[model samples]
Target chain A: MDTPHPGPDLHPHCTIVPPYLLVRLAKLDDPRFAQAAAAARESLLRDSQIRQLRGGEHPFTYSGARTLPARTPGESDRTISDAGGQERLPGRRVRAEGQPAGSDPAVNEAYDSLGATQALFWTQFGRDSIDGLGLPMDATVHYGKQYDNAFWDGERMVFGDGDGQVFNRFTISPSVIGHELTHGVTQFTANLQYEGQSGALNESISDVFGALVEQHTRGQSSAEASWLIGDGLFTDQVEGVALRSMKAPGTAYNDDVLGKDPQPGSMADYIETDDDNGGVHLNSGIPNRAFYLVADALGGNAWERPGRIWYNTLTGTGLGRESDFAAFAAATAATAAQLHGIGGAAHNAVLQAWVTVGVMTGRE
Target chain B: MKVIVSRSGGMAGIRLTWEVRVEEQPDPATWADFLNSLPWDDVTDSEAAPDRFAYRIRCAPHEVVLGETQVNGPWRDLVNRVRAANGM
Candidate 1:
């Protein structure tokens, strides 16, 4: 029997930090931030090269030299590798499934964060792994010389040690790990095109699940959660609480070297530009706030009701690769109404949340 | 001769710019020769990869946008020189 298959041909090089922020970091002339500047420039070059490799007409295919293990449902198999400051992936394997904690802090942190992310999906969404097929989760630490970003290259997650002056280890925040992994989930599900408003929605969906993973792990109510994306990723030297704030956009960071966060929380402040994949990271704040409002209005565990609505909309049939903010809002409201009764608290909450963020759900 | 290059696109979609006046260079003749040797006309417009960087070069009457991978030879050398001059 043929099983339901994931959609065709959409692979995005999803990264936790946007290139614009890195560009600012790269252009800093301050003596104190020189290392960060160099690292950011190197990351940009490497990222560009990787994108070129992945953007060919034919899909990337693996050779037959290596074989993957048989997938076991409901089991999580994780591997953490150490790159040893080289710009290579899945470097020397340092830790594996069922292995004891390693001596390296980065390795241990990556291992634990991967487990947390896996637990969140398994316990809440019934997703065994990124592909829901018990696909082995893998990560690499110490990716490059003072590398300042983390990314999911349509396969495994790669992280950098970061310039100690500006950023910390990518594995420091569990939500970041969840955020990157959710991209894999999206690749298998809606596979939203990573450009313009659709790209913003794609980013918002990851942030929503990323926040939920953190909240679920901490058992925090919607009111109690911080709603910050990369809360602890920034060093104390930077004048920032996190990379992006779901609760309040455009307020995550403001520093002499880092520049101000450009995220817009409402459609009124939406930016129109031809850069950063049409401002995916900047415009994501609108939908991020929408989800936050819905969770706040409903009260209680967000991953249960609000999270379910978002997840259903993501995996549901109506969601297309090019879905924009309005389309997503309507889908969520429809999902809420389907899960709950018409005009129920959940449905009204979803609609009101979208409207509060200046996005019409058209649920009337 | 005066040239301006604007680099945009990347994971974050931010834009960076650099401008150079050939006559103002410490060695004007050397800079002019360097600019003239570049294969500017050969840099064709191409589709950009999602979230990858692209560049726009505006040097007087000629203007062209090239994807990040298409930036090589003199294009890469010029961009690198500008970035180095800016202390990047």
Candidate 2:
């Protein structure tokens, strides 16, 4: 018997993880945290080297692999490809710039998301694309048979048809689009290594903006926002609301097989593990909570003052490849101070948020 | 031999594991041959891509970890069989 597909999740936004998880970097006097920093660095170097060594392996069939920013000051350049269930990438050109919606839901959804994400960076942050120079967004959908994951390969966004047991489809959630695309943005900007604390930061950065992309499109305030990542990716068989909750960490889901949400919103409960890049997805709960707190305190559209502070810190060049949670917290506080004056509402909100999350020791 | 397959580090950061006791399978010899066919020596556990599933396969004393892309051919064969045997 065939099951009726409920279709793609329309309003919900979800982003899964891709943390490097080497050493987690030392934080809050915890000497045990090497979380995957070294491995993360090694992997990043190896990935770049692989790119150089493994050229011509993927078929560059599409001409819009990168659409230039010459059309207008803020126009988006996008290309969507279909893998047709083979493992190869950038499979075949199915859609291009300014194409009408096709019968396939995955293609249409990806196209709309790319446009929305591009619009967020352009209108809100005055930035061009994933890169400020207006990098064209490229994505491949329907990759592999029941391939339950979506990832960014430092070049294009690759999405898969979920197994239909636990997940629906990668494109079901708009936040996932923002989340994966934000990984591109992070690579272009701070380029945080994906392991441990920095890895968690990498994941958190994507979630922060992933939610922002959703909120901006829906015009929802911080209070009105769901603050849940991967909200509707799970099937009815799984007992979960979303993948992770930014407002309340570790409260997103609880299932018999998937187990409970292992995310921790504070350092005291920080999970130290060798998997998930030293719990890059788990420990990210701390920073995600911090951002939510900041937005809650600011009491307006989160994309306005709160997002500006985050956007400035992200592009300010203050973050290093190995920057831990504390360093990132300090940078955001400084950015808030510089932008909204010391002891001002935004600055205080940043400090209080970090302190609450145990990233920073005090309200400094 | 007991084979365990643990999947972690995806977009959701959730982990699911399944295992099969090769000795208890209907065709133990065939399962062992398939398990032994995996390219274990070539797996370097350093490279991890963002938001991809990482698999840890442990068959007795020999253990190997592979990213999502590497789980094909013999590797995919081993994982799928294990999950099926375990009724996962």
Candidate 3:
């Protein structure tokens, strides 16, 4: 709680200066290095007190102003850290790439889940990592005290331990991990504005590939896959199977405390609201159901053609930052035609799925 | 004062809401002071982080939606105060 006042410059070298060195610098009695000492203290305070927002959510869609980190061009480079019940991020590195499994279940689960997501991208779409050039996939677990959420803070994934009353530990589900990691992928690519349809699309994209990651890992066919985004996250006390069900959007849960799942399966039922960033989480069910239909129709492995279409459309230059359901559907259809031929099964499936989901009227 | 605290937009995509009447609390003056002490006009309207817990805290004419990162310092104190008052 002893947060020091930030220095004039705001400590640009906080990352380079180790915490121990920063601590020593912060306590040094030198007047000349007062700014340096204050900067160190500010950095330390950031680590101690604040939950780093990082770029403050990039108010506008990326217009190529922000360049992602350079690629490593190999296997996934990962680092898992522990927040130790604090709101700080990347708290302390507990597991790194190629390290043996740690004793903490959350740490190991995070490590494995990240690897699975990386493997799905690489093995299926030739994507190297979240950014496709092998950007490191890192995560932080056990963040905050009984924290009930997991988020991608533009740079890395941060997970809460969950309240345990309604939700279990977040790391218990691989799909949740995949969902968070995909946000990084979205950030690097479409950079969808996190509001309204675009925000819902942002949420839906994460859920689509998220479920795919788990299915790819289980080697389950489309029918075998649960199509639920947070499968094991709910405690038995909560009357829910998962957070969002792609197969049946609003049917994921109906509880007294959590209330009925407010998601709509089609444009006919799309919710219009200002909360949750224009109901990004609620209206996402429309696209989510669309993706599910495509996967179900394709029938062997959902991540193959269906996954390729979604992934390509996301990474491809067809989408705008503010792409609506129709626009994204059109983009996906274009991708399907590009991947599979025009009038082909994959292309046809996408058309029918979008039309059925009311994302589009009909194929041109 | 009547205050509404609603959290939404996490990875779970769940929304939880609570309504608190400061007048009904043991100390109404402190609650008024607490609400006045917050920077209601300084809230950033954009999404702060993906899937991070955010709150829509409204007190009559003053209302703001804050991302988890913004819900620190005095913001955190206000939120915790509301939650504690609600017995959450």
Q: Candidate 3's residue-wise lDDT over B1-88, tens digit each?
A: 7999999888887888878899999999998988888888887766456787779999989988887777778888888888888888
True contacts kept of each: 0.18, 0.64, 0.73
Chain B TM-score, candidates in order = 0.88, 0.89, 0.90
Best by lDDT: 3
Shift of residue A129 alpha carbon in model 2, Å:
0.7
Clashing pairs in 1: A18-B12, A19-B12, A276-B13
- Candidate 2 lDDT, tens digit per residue, B47-83? 6678888888898778988888788788888888888
Q: Tens digit of lDDT per residue, candidate 1, span B3-47?
A: 887876443333568888778777889877887887767766564
Error of 2 at A252 (Å): 0.9
lDDT of each: 0.76, 0.80, 0.82
Per-residue lDDT tens digits for candidate 2, residues A1-364, read: 1121122211111111122211121121232323333334444445545435535121111112122223564678899999999879899989998988999999998999999998887787777677565567999999988988888888899999898998989898889899999988887667787889998999999999999999989999999999999878899999999899999999999999788999999998998887787788889999999999999999878888888788878776567667899999999999989988999999999999999988887835
Best by DockQ: 2
TM-score of each: 0.76, 0.84, 0.83
TM-score of 3: 0.83
Q: What stretches of model 2 exceed 4 Å from their correct place?
A: A1-69
Q: State in Å the error of residue A328, model 2.
A: 0.6
- Interface DockQ per candidate: 0.16, 0.63, 0.56
Once fitted onto the true fold, the runs of candidate 3 whose alpha carbons sit more than 4 angstroms away are: A1-72
